[model samples]
Target: MLVTGVKIQGRADEAQWVTQFKVQYSNDGNSWTFVQHTNNQSDMIFDGNTDRSTISTNIFPAQVTAAYIRLVPTAWHIHISMRFEILGCKECKTPLGMKNRDIPATRIKVSSRGEYYIINSNDNTSTHHKGGSHARLDRFHYWVPDNDDINPWVQVYVGLGKIVSGIIIQGFKQHWTRHDFIKVQVNGSIFESINANLESTWTHDHPASHATLMFEKPVVTSVVRVEPNDCSETTRKLTNGNQIVILDCALRMELLGCGNIPEHGCVKPLGMETGDIQGTQIRVSYNHHQSNESRLNYRGYWGGSSPNINRWIMVYFGYVVNISGIVIQGYEVYWVELFVIEEMNNPTIGTQEYAANFDGYTPVTVLFEKLVHTTYIKVTPTACHNGYCGVRMEILGICDDNSNP
Candidate 1:
């Protein structure tokens, strides 16, 4: 589930109402990370109800994807006593752009890697056939290598930093094949083997039999490969008193995941330089310098009208977005030395920050510990060169919103 907020009700007795608390969330229920404060060092403290009946609701700084959530109380009216409920919308798993051409055909690679094939696709011993790009599910397309190419395999470049949870595999409609020998590889490591029966009992016009392979845990990888461990085939008799054999490894496939995996393969600049974002999308809190109104790009640098600690530049995406990092560039010699990034879910809530530091006009990329989903990203300069602060940046993330179904 994508956790967005939390609602807490104090105890019936006013004397025992909880006053302040912190929230921690985990995907595996074993390892945990908390919602941090603007300082980026401690857990964010949320205010509780003053009265026993009134419910205190708090929204997270950014949407968190987790299977388990825990609340820790820091302060209370008398003693810690409360009831609460986690809030968020259900997240559905969509195709990670494999079946559809969201993932380009160039990113899909095919080869004969194992020892089962006598004809190698790479050795120029025979004509090479593309397999991975043709492995689309239910498209009447199947990846069948050349004859005697027993070690057919497909590899997909899902991006350098992306999450994959599972995959769906199907066999050709005209053939009944067993795909139990196929296995899944993430970043060169064998995670699990596909043990599904790929037999198709349908006709050419009907849907073929398929299987879903879910992982024990979501794997973060740049590549995903599907290969077979052993050769398996079926035999048929011809009307001319002859015998024919068919390879059972021919199959089609699709990937399962969430986030902005479909739009771009990995983290890319989010339109500051490309003019995809308009001037209305950016704002600065105290631009006394009256620098260019549009300071989001290198054309101008955002500077505060007066020297103040509260100087901040913000980008309002107008909609929910998933971001992995930000690329910062300074103007000439006036540049920010230290800064903090804040993901805002609300005006009052989500004041938490992630700290970053860099030097010079050279562009520096600051990656968050994890992907953040929010509508607004605010950057505040903590320290600057010669007390003059300026900022020109591009967001590093996928272009599409993954929060919806």
Candidate 2:
């Protein structure tokens, strides 16, 4: 179970503030056990600001399994309200974590020089992983680099840029020595470093069976790299003619941003397919807004005139999908003002509409209350904020099959 965040309400008085607490979970709702961190420590204290009318805490933990979880206050001045959000599991007491946002079957390319001893050649090709199956020890299901290699690394191209927060690395339980040092990179920039042995010493407990490297802040990028480093050659090695480095290691990386909405194969501008507005300056190209780049010239147009001008573009997904949200980025000076979204079903139905004014240069997201399934979506613009209209948009959804078609 992933604990995403916590919400505390009640009085801001010092007497009601909770300074310390314990996170305990139970299988049968009777006997509860405290959740341990890297080491065996069980005490978790409030970080940063604590005195407030409302407190919002953001914490993302690796997946856990238990029936019931509750926070027991160790130190508090007065009675207050507290709420913990457990994410990723439907059967748990909290909401589910956002499912993998990366398109399934997205190509994952690794360095050619790295040695792969026990892993299958096809094991690293897919973006999806079995959730909460960290105990599996088959090397064929993991991506293991050769111990002799100086710098072994793996890279995943998400097909487009996305916001990434954390990575889960499953360690081999049998004869493999842990990867003592590891570093993560996003878009070729260093994101975080982990000295697992050192971390265990500070926490006064042994390292976990799986290593979770979480960024203090989230990053937006299209590429992610995990590099394992052998700090000392004297470390114990796995013996099978080849030195044992990581015998059977798996990864479950988490992303937090949006991805492209329309299928690349079926994307077409309003006029391009129908030859309606032949000379318009704006046209839809699937790759234009797939990244964070804010190119002033590359944009799609929804053309119309005056206060009641209506312009729209239609997109087909090839099949039905569960749409969760949409992210829109506009030109430096022109952004769509009033717009409505409709999905194609039996007769075509309007799903949602927006009338709020937005700044042209900033990115804004519109999240649906619940996921909806549709094969096609029509985005219609009713007004423009600056009389000029163009936008770069992405639809955030997953197919019913949960795979790339």
Candidate 3:
């Protein structure tokens, strides 16, 4: 379908009309692309109905062809209520063949978990467990790992390559809000992170439910791993009268993708894990006495002199290239909670701010709105987690020989 525009009618109540909205299109309905204005290249916002019975219609600057279209309410008069009609011409019919379902327990694999917190078992028919370790909703809840596993992960294998758009993760039913930050890995390498800190406002009617994390780009892979970086823990008494502490708990998971891999499905990482980058090229404004600035070890990272503002780490890419994003990981116990990137590609562009990495292990990938072509870039840590400034990162995007002029 070629989606050309949208027609919306507000509710009978005049106070419940939507004032502004933005449209987004998706091929699989899981990953969405925003409709942009040709003039500004920004998300196109449509002026909505002001009264109850008025039908407001807004046309798109350019037609978008997709399987599904959604309207996001940007502003509302009092409450958001609307009846929408999609305007489009029936050209080539796009079938809704995407299958999104929970990955079976048999295909799930965890790094390590508690004795009663069974993960790999295929017994999901019953919601009740003998030890009362299962949630009322399902048996897949509460994957409590041992306290020794600082960073625990749950992996899913789909037999063959599938185009994965996202994953659904639910928190423990008995616990409050957990899983603030989680990293997604496709195949064997880190892909991205669920940057949004998800937490349910527990209630009888609205209990803790799953949060769907959509990727920036769909990945074609047979295996996908999810690791919870920062999950708060609580000591619980087991059925055997033993009290144990669970670390970085993940309750339930579901894969969100179906269909064969496309020809261009995956994006390759630029130079962090592949060793294409040298250590000596990295420069730091201030290095901690106990840390090395040039080491890329997972256990070790570049730490600032003190957990203070204005500390920075710069990387020289040898040659200019169109840099897109970055993946930053923390040291053993030191990590930066907030930082900004200064791309030397354009001096007038200044710095772009980003906040991530709730823990010291899982890498947080931050994407940029525009491509940065620069030979060197700097990152300044504005906020540190627990007053520890640590960082290790990899640059994303391809290096172009023609860009080195």
Candidate 4:
């Protein structure tokens, strides 16, 4: 769909100075209704500027029935907004309404999460490519040893924000030494600590450096810090000198989507599966390499077939707006399977499994999730009947700013 490019001048250019905005719409200009009322995250909107940020794209499959669109700035005290058309469409189909749900906005915050990021005074923006752990959502995000004597460190402070309850920090820990340690401290006071030597440790000692940090009961003060006591003994813990760290903050910030693979800074982790079938990737081919090729008909195996080792896996994100659909790139085979589980750790008889959607040429983005939840997800491809095939897939959906995951 094409839009005439909206330009919000004056205070709309900054969101901090703006609080709420009223959005209205019209199908035939004869009937108009209020559609959305949003409280901006920041009141940065300033005066005397023609800068407009693409706020949110709620309308999906843009072809849906609508005639005109407009936004009324709260700062302007003007309920009257601008007007725009539905591009080529000329008919109104549905009533004007807010497409998003009325759930309370999510919030997550943490202080002194001791995983992923390394906080040191050595930060030099000019020292680009200089590797170290980084923090996000008030927690550390990366622990990979991308630098000499690299260690994951982070310092966080969640100033007593209103309505804050607590914080949760989770991560994977690999034990390089028999006495591996993971600690948590809050308000300059040590709360709890764990180590490989601890009887409750569920993992065994591996050369890999896998560890998690959770500093609970933070003071909600204006300052905090955390770092490895000394990881030099875990020198062999470096898995390619890199360790991926993840933290879920539950107080100050919602889990925001780390946009497009950053061109610089740290590297991005590629999907466990995203490549040609078997050529430098897990291959997807027919196991029916028999003299009587007719015995390996693909149509006959529509119901089911031999289990191929080319297992399929995907990371789902819940609450993402504009993610209308997805596409997969693989051999144009119909043998797509989806295994949905209720929990990542456990599966039951109620687990639901369905076949995935495959385009005639490649696999379309499988609509395997309405939102990202580990409750359940799995994939199995159908028989190729012929040979290993090459593929590249793409997905298209509503592109907006509201990233809820």
Candidate 5:
């Protein structure tokens, strides 16, 4: 994307900020594409920021070949002299002059490699991550914007020497697709643009109106292709077609490949939080906020690592009225495994993602049938990388007011 107008009439070296700008994109969280003023082409439309100078910019569609996009600061600032504002975005627009309070234009900070970044809509990539992309099939990769006219491209891979059995492609997590469509394919086949909602007389998990593409009796394939299609499958008040906003995508396969749900593709061992260090895993609770660390009280935050081959820890404890459900807040979290123990003295076990495809700005919540009664709740990182959770969980109880557990 070409930059609109930027000028630092600050004189001499003071005009440093106008030197460069950057935009970035991300599909599965691993690889990234960055376009900036550091390029060979010079597209700065404006030379200086005057009182009534029209401000604007261009969005090269080619840059965003993934799920989400964001605007970040590309040019390095040497001193406190660099300061300016970007204007005019054909793809993403905000309030013209003065204050721009739109959601997409909100300033967000991202961590890359090992440093912090403050960015806006001018950049093309998002730093939001749910603990690394390849961590699990159940977790979600969310990218929300005010406008759906824009399509985000996402790439799915099978790594190397990986094989798997059947695969199931589901939408909205709970809704299953009869066919197991691959996220990434062998060849560079963008995606099947047309979306098809499932026909009736189908199996459960099929929405009253659902969209499913299941691969029964399927073989192992290296790379699978998944992209956004413009068409939609409008049926039975259910639009499972690919046209949805695509908050997240859940792939179910065996081995390194994706796995379908209900049908446990690969069985792997998980971890349990022994009450030794953090006490018993009676009931784990947490909450999330824009400025969370400052909003809530916590020891710290940590994410998970890998999938299939990882173990998730569960905290158990005693409480009154048993338990109802669990909630988590996060930027990008692939998937999470929930667990509960009947008693602190007894052993606690791991549970598959009772909830899958968790995404968006709101907190990620999932309800289960298992009854929980404890003072301790173990929280462990399973899929993706290792680090802090997106949202702090608040392990809601049957009763809202009292922590009478």
Candidate 6:
């Protein structure tokens, strides 16, 4: 079903008006699920009048397939009555369906090992094997517990609650056995054992190296844990005497609904320029550094001189776009003490100036009060600390071209 528009009829004062409302759908009419409304990761709303309001067509871009759709008031001025117009069609396509909705995890912890497993104890020079901290699910490096307990598990924290659809687990391949039987828990729920084995040959490059467990329906949760069952027995022996029951486990999870499209910096260096810098490595944007530090090999944009005040770098996106926020990642040596972000309608015309306060060598996000439409953004460091000032920056904005905006 396509939700064409919404007509809200209510009488209330300005303080009692219902401004924000979220659409909830239910297939069984008893249990309801929230529908994703906008790219800003918020539900749909009817803003403006306090008494009566009529929303036009295509108010909800997402396709609604529930038997019942209810408008739940989140922020309201008073009691209200709402009428939703449902337009029936063969199919309703939403922008969310056009993009991948895999949510990134903020932290991944193992029940036995914290985050990394040190291979050698004496020299402390051995490779640090990451259990669940690594982003890639297919990597051979995995987390191994001290003992092969029957309930060794790995948990992923998405930081925020999200609707998840499936979970993928990759087991270590020693001689033959792969982690076939496991238990899954969502948000401290009871552990449900599942036999997610792919009956295929155990080769170095086999496609069945990983097993995926899909839920019957989407599950709204922030934490997911995968525990090895009794069936997951390994013959490999540890340095101690106990037999290894659990091997290296890697995980990859997917969300049910479409996630917000991330705003990326301009790839083409059309009108990108920086102030006087030290060397030739001046361009610092999304392309300069990798998302994670493990894969980051290149140094970020570095200024020519030592840490000084009033150093600046400007970038033009080629066209006008609405920017919501900016992210800056600092290096280990030098970082910005105080910085100013200025939006420009033209290359030479500067608009409003926003000051950003953050710590050094850490990634910080500075959000604007409202979306600013501009073609140029200039980042000027008013103060710095440590050594030479350099940073990797990203512009979070509404793209005019793709499904992200």
The estimated TM-scores of all candidates read 0.42, 0.31, 0.46, 0.25, 0.26, 0.35
Estimate, for each residue in 1-405, the C-alpha lDDT of model 2 and write its tens digit.
333223343344444556556567677899876655423454444332255454433232222345677776666555554444443323222111212322332234343322332333353321223222221222233444444545656555443324455554444323222444556675322233522222112110322344444554344344556765532322233453333223333333332323322232111122222333232322333322322232222454333233444455555665665565454556656677666777754344354455422545434444443344566666666667667565556665543232235
Summarize candidate 4's per-residue lDDT along 68-104 as a digit string, tens digits: 6655566532332322212222221221111121111
Model 1 lDDT per residue over 51-136, tens place: 67765656564456788999999888777899887865455256878788788887777774211223333443323343566678
Instruction: Report the number of clashing residue pairs per model.
Output: 2, 6, 0, 49, 79, 5
Candidates ranked by lDDT, best first? 1, 3, 6, 2, 5, 4
Model 1 regions more than 4 Å off: 2-68, 73-89, 112-130, 145-152, 158-163, 173-180, 187-207, 219-223, 233-246, 259-405
Please tell me which model should have the higher TM-score, number 3 or number 5.
3
The C-alpha lDDT values of all candidates are 0.62, 0.43, 0.58, 0.28, 0.30, 0.44
Clashes of 6: 5
* lDDT (10s digit) by residue, model 3, range 1-405: 556567688897456889899999999989998989654799977878777776665656555667999999999877999988886545322211212233445555666655433222353322222211221123444565545667667666553334555655565555422444668776323334433323334332332565656555444454566776665656666675555444435455555654332212112365556566666667787763432343433456777547455678777877776565566777777787878788774543354457656556655555454345688877777777777777877766544332453
Residue range 1-405, candidate 6, lDDT tens digits: 333234344442233345567667788889987766434666555442344442222233333556777777776555554433443332222211101323232345565652332333353432344444442455444455434444566665442223344555454445222344556666322233433433324343553264445554333334556665433324444574433334344333222322221122211112112221122223333323322221111254444343344456655555665565555545666556556677674444244443332333334444443345676667776555553455555555544432122
Candidate with better lDDT, 3 vs 5: 3
Worst 10 residues of 3 by lDDT: 92-101
Any idea how many clashes model 2 has?
6
Off by over 4 Å in 6: 1-166, 173-319, 324-371, 375-389, 396-405
What is the model-wide C-alpha lDDT for candidate 2? 0.43
TM-score of 6: 0.35
lDDT tens per residue, model 5, 1-405:
112222232224453333234455566666765643322443322222222222222223111223434444434335323343332222211111111111121122111111112243454423433211322233343222112323323333332112222223333344332342323332112122322332224343642232333322122222333433332322122242212222223222112222211111111111111112222232233222222221111333323332334333343433533343444434444233332333343344444433321332223333333224445444454432133343234443332222352
lDDT value for model 3: 0.58
Deviation (Å) of 69 in candidate 6? 8.3
Give the TM-score comparing model 5 with the true structure, all chains together: 0.26
